[model samples]
Target: MLGRVLGGISTSLFFATFECWMVAEHRRCGFGEELLRYMFGLMFSVQYLAAIGAGLVAQAAASVVPLTRLSASSSWHYGGYTAPFDISLACLLLAIPAIQMSWTENYGNNKAGAAGTGIAASLRAGARAMGSSWQVPILGLAVATFEGSMYCFVFNWTPALDAGGGLPPPHGLIFSSFMMACMCGSSFFGMLDSSYRPVKVLLPVILTAAAALGLTALSLARGSTSNGAVFAGFLIFEACVGAYFPCVGTVKSEVVPEEARAGVYNVYRVPLNAFVIFLLLTDISPATQFGACCCLLSVAAGAVWLLGRVEQTR
Candidate 1:
């Protein structure tokens, strides 16, 4: 339980704090928005590549250990002493020096006090900031709806592949493939963002994602065993996932004030977590759940379109 709590805290720090720091630094340096978009693309592309490499290293470490939980879990040595957590620790240790030596510590200008406000205070401010503009809440709507669908993809992808009677899917290999597809999407973002605004780009991205998931859900609902079609659809969805991170970041960076950036950014995860937790508590069919995601994406597309209109007027 303590480990999970720590992990949750770490996840928040990773997604919120690191991004807040980078964007603050970028603005401090006075770079162009074009450059910021480029950095987002390059950063995520490299991060995906690192994920692939880390997965490979972890698999190598895991396979070295004796299999103990084979009957109960497809993952044998995971979370064991010989698992990737050791490598994760080592990597974190290595990162400490690089960060301490090279990176400057950045903080949000919390007007509440120099000592800073607590989580609840930050969230309250974030919520208030959301109310201040049409774009903020609309951006939040886009994030919540799209990411609500995305978390479903994260949990369902492996089972969707494994349902066909066959050898268990190579989990690591499949993950690496997904990351590569995301890298492709990231590269695509770099190319497109150079020409089009991120808001404009998100319209087709959300639509393509919706279509991909819709097709896959249709197949699953029909009791079809065509894994090829499902895999193709999933890859398409992941590419959209790659495009979304930088695009969403760029959009939010434009709309959300820096003072409330991390707070509001973290607040966007509220609905996503709630959606995922509700799904976890329910016994809904995967096809039904995934189809629900398609519907939500349609809603997100509408939101994005309206946001585009709003952006045009502004």
Candidate 2:
């Protein structure tokens, strides 16, 4: 429960930071075409890597410590060790505005061309660039919603599958393998993106359909005489989830303005919070109903992709 709370808080802080960073970057870049490319490659790399390190350290500490002890202390005191992880997180959150200030000083005042615009003008230009595109904002919302729903379904269903469906420990391994497949899928998609506009990419729809098929197979296997079919369906479903993930971020980046990319990316997080509340409050059968929900979400995601394309054409 504490983990969930902390995770939510952390996610919120992360998005807040991202939004601030986006606005700052826009102010700094003066609506430059390649602002996102620059920010993602340089600034975001540092921020994300720091976040990853923090997560790893936190995980390692939790693994070694007793949960009760950790919760008992006001600080992050666990077992026999006391570390400043909480303090560090707090400090990181506080540092976001400072980081923005630094970015503003560095790039916000620079003249890119003969326009000789001030930082305020640059920010306005960036805002205008973002406001020019409706596709970016809608796609951003869709990506966030899809991701939040996916996480909720996965978290709620996995344990239910283990208990209700009688899936063994090996099922966890299968899930991990599915994640690896997703990494591969993302790499494949990146390569494809080099040759095509990400919005024109059809992989999201294809993968969504595949995921739906997998879920449908699982649903059909619920009353099956053979367990093999059910297990295979689970594996297929997981793989499809993995394959579809890359498209979510790609779509966001493709549609959002260069300056507002981070802010738009952060907006994708709302679905996650909403989904958690949904899972907690709802009394649905995890395996059967949740699988149906997954299928429905996949269909909806595919429809979103199609609608985005139609909007693009018009």
In every candidate, how many clashes are there?
0, 2
Which candidate gets the maximum TM-score versus the true structure?
1
User: What's the TM for model 2?
Assistant: 0.56
Error of 2 at 176 (Å): 2.8
For model 2, give the 10-residue run with minimal summed lDDT: 105-114
Q: What is the lDDT of residue 224 in candidate 1?
A: 80
TM-score of each: 0.90, 0.56
**Residue 250 displacement (Å), model 1:** 0.5
Report per-prediction Cα RMSD to one decimal.
3.3, 7.5
lDDT of 1 by residue, 1-314 (tens): 99888987887788787778878889888888789988989899999999888777776776677545656656644443367777889999998899899987665454446356678877987998989999998888889899989988888887888886578776666788888889999889987737798999999999999999999999888888768888899999999999998898888888999888878988988887787778757878778888989998999999999999998898
Candidate 2 at 3: error in angstroms? 3.5
lDDT of 2 by residue, 1-314 (tens): 99779877777656544544554555555675344433433343344335445545554554465544446546644442243355466766888888777654322233354255544654455456546776654554455545555565556544544553543444324444445444444444444434454455544544554465455446554655444444555445544444444444444545555444433444445555666567656775555555545654665566567656766688
The candidate scoring highest on lDDT is 1
Report the alpha-carbon TM-score of model 1 versus the true structure.
0.90
Q: Candidates' lDDT values, in order?
A: 0.84, 0.51
Candidate 1 positional error at 119, Å: 2.2
